[model samples]
Target: MKTESSAELTLRGTKTESRVELTLRGLVLGVVLTVVFTAANVYFGLKAGLTFSTSIPAVVISMAMLRWLGNTSAQENNIVQTVASTAGTLSSIIFVLPGFIMIGWWSGFPYWQSVAICATGGILGVMYSIPLRRALVTDSDLPYPEGTACAEVIKVGSGDVADKDSVESSGKGLKAVLVGSLVSALFLVMVQARLFLGDVAHSFRL
Candidate 1:
């Protein structure tokens, strides 16, 4: 076995240390750049379509932006950008799904029914991906750019230096339960108190 002198060992250690620092720096910068690009994707999509498309292209654009702004390695940028972009894409899908009912597509059903379906679909999307994680991340090399981007955002944003704001979303089923209950109770109270009259006293002439 070849033994290295202490000086050679020290030099190698320093080189490794430098590489790690550089990698960290790249990741931090990539995270910021990715956020900017994601905002742009949402703005442009809303402008163009009055709705956002959750296609992979938006995230791909963010990755490109990371390269441009951070001058990081393509592989590193891809990892973070993929994650950030995917979040926006998935969120857009959740936001837009309910609109299907607005233009007469889902008219016959109560509005709350449409809302429930959308909320359910949003939750299901997350669950659906869980089973596919191994296949998508490992076996297929599917280039789930959005998933990669989302992971990156979480990793980067969790840092002390990142913004601390937090937001939570719930399914429409829960919302509907609350709102519907309130509305129904109010309606019942009004009807029972004779505050509002229905066609209870009307006689059909035809």
Candidate 2:
């Protein structure tokens, strides 16, 4: 019996989110990552049938770049990561479009047909995921390792992991990231020069 009219309801003292939460710098960073990731992924996938995950990389890069912006917030970096991750997660159309040509199903690029197919597939995927997410994610205990790891990265970058030790740990975290990047870069360069193999696949009869 405590129902109140619409006019009586109020969020009287709620704090408003910062305007910097979705600033132009965040959008620009997201756009840059999106284009770079999409192009690199498409090329690498077609060439080697392998594509790197963008979610954590986008989050890490956004945090690093946004560190120079005094006004940047965790929400802004989340937006950037989400936008860039779309390139890696939502570009499944690439898998089929190229296959059509390779399989001789299409002699050449059919622009309109490709567009329609991609649009339909994307829409269906979105709609289907709504229910599947609830079932497999919301109601279930299935461990989503990538999502969990990304959240840990976000917390560490935002200093949400610790109040007292944040400053000290942050420097250590940056050092670890730099060392990992350097090692990865050197390994990739050697792989490209054929001094090492990126992967090895072996098969034998059972």
Candidate 3:
């Protein structure tokens, strides 16, 4: 028996065309999102040595923005999200790149050198992923927690998921994420403003 994946079910009847998927607007949005996310990723990585996945956020933002621009298709937003996520994720190179500066290997980043490094890294990643697509993503049963979650986000945004229960569950998940994000942002703002200490440390002998 050929078991269908949740992604197959969610993406049913959603294939419009490759032309729409590669529209000028979609490409422009993707580039804009890439710049935004890469900058944010570099900043966060350098500051805290941590970077969060921007895939779901990019998907959600793409869907919302394209909807506002007028009639939009899932394929277009897929391009937008893919570009943004790939660029943002790969920008983690900042983690190692900065070390060169810190170790006095270079005084400042040379623009062409950084560009070449990023381009080569991105190309190698794509080359490796092409071979692994079937073995890891298609044939394997390994639970991809983050990939699954991002798919659910896209499914809910697309509103064409075949399973009613899946749509409802994904909707709930999206709402939870929104509420949690708002609360966390508020708390962070308060902490930054010194409304309350974000951490407390006291030395005592006991």
lDDT of each: 0.45, 0.70, 0.73
lDDT of 3 by residue, 95-197 (tens): 7777889999889999998888888998999999999877776676766776676666666666565546544554565567679769967998999999978
**Best candidate, TM-score-wise?**
3
Sequence-dependent TM-score of model 3:
0.71
Q: Point out where model 1 deviates above 4 Å.
A: 1-27, 50-75, 87-130, 140-206
Model 1 lDDT at residue 144: 46
| Candidate 3, position 142, lDDT | 66
Q: RMSD, each candidate, Å?
A: 18.8, 7.4, 4.7
Clashing pairs in 3: none
Off by over 4 Å in 2: 1-24, 162-206
Ranking of candidates on TM-score, top first: 3, 2, 1
Give the lDDT of residue 69 in candidate 1.
Answer: 52
lDDT of 1 at 38: 54
Clashes of each: 7, 0, 0
Error of 2 at 35 (Å): 0.9
Model 1 per-residue lDDT tens digits across residues 163-193: 3331111122224545865996798789789
